[model samples]
Target: MQTAGDETVITVYIGLGSNLAEPAMQVRRACEALGQLPESRLLACSSLYSSPPMGPPDQPDYINAVAALETTLSPHDLLAELQAIEQAQGRVRERRWGARTLDLDLLLYGDRQIDDQQLTVPHVGLPERAFVLYPLQEIAPTLVIPGQGPLADLVTRCPENGLQRYE
Candidate 1:
């Protein structure tokens, strides 16, 4: 965390995904909403990407992106705000990795490794998800996941998995 006067600010990375309700628009709008988050400023957002679903093959393809934010909110507090954004965008918890209107994941919280029941920084699947890694590389190519080594190395090891940059 960086000290700005008395407040502590952390750079966070959020993974955004949606396969329902015009996904690309959902992701773009969510990025806008992130910029509006209290005690946070959106630093960078990657271009949208299209990828095959990671869960049920029967579901539609997903639109994904990564966003960088510098926030004074604590990890859990930042996570709560992210969940609120997902809910406001019509996200539902029907099933694990099910298709959704919006999915916002707290991928990283500064350089911290958090393993609480409510959230996990450097997201549990961050190392293997191409959709997450690719967009993340676009925005923060030099980032080193708190526990997962360097971003570029991870990207090199993770296949495209049918993920493509959205035109």
Candidate 2:
């Protein structure tokens, strides 16, 4: 974490996923878009992973990765930007856990915990989701998840049935 004048810059972790419209390309493009976010810089990104669909199994598999970022934007504002990116990418919210062109989830925002209707930090499913845990563990294994514990520990308890490191 750093400060720009009075504004605080927080190191945030983001999860990116796509299952449609050239999944890998969509993810790479989203990574580029993340770097372009206001007052944010992409620090490091984990290698992509291929994971089975979480919500429904019938859909296509997803391309997933986690990113570390430094940002001055408040959590809500950053969430808004992410939603905008999804909207721009032709994302349709017609079904829950449906296939998507692009999906950006704010996995961790510093060490702060937020649980509002609009956003949830340490993403509600971070601990149990293999897709998220895999890439996050890859990029920042020693990282702690505030209300939870070390990411390394979290990664251990989670099953790795559907996660494959995308080469």
Question: 137-167 in candidate 1: lDDT tens per residue?
Answer: 9999898988779999999999998999997
Q: Write the per-residue lDDT of candidate 2 for residues 1-167, one digit (tens) a residue.
A: 77999999999999999999999989988998898999999998899999989888889999999999999999999999999998988888879899999999999999999999999998998999999998998889789999998999988899997799897
* TM agreement with the true structure for every prediction: 0.98, 0.97
Each model's lDDT comes to: 0.94, 0.92
Q: Stretches of candidate 1 above 4 Å error?
A: none
Which candidate achieves the best lDDT against the true structure? Answer: 1
- Scored against the true structure, residue 79 in model 2 reaches a CA lDDT of 96
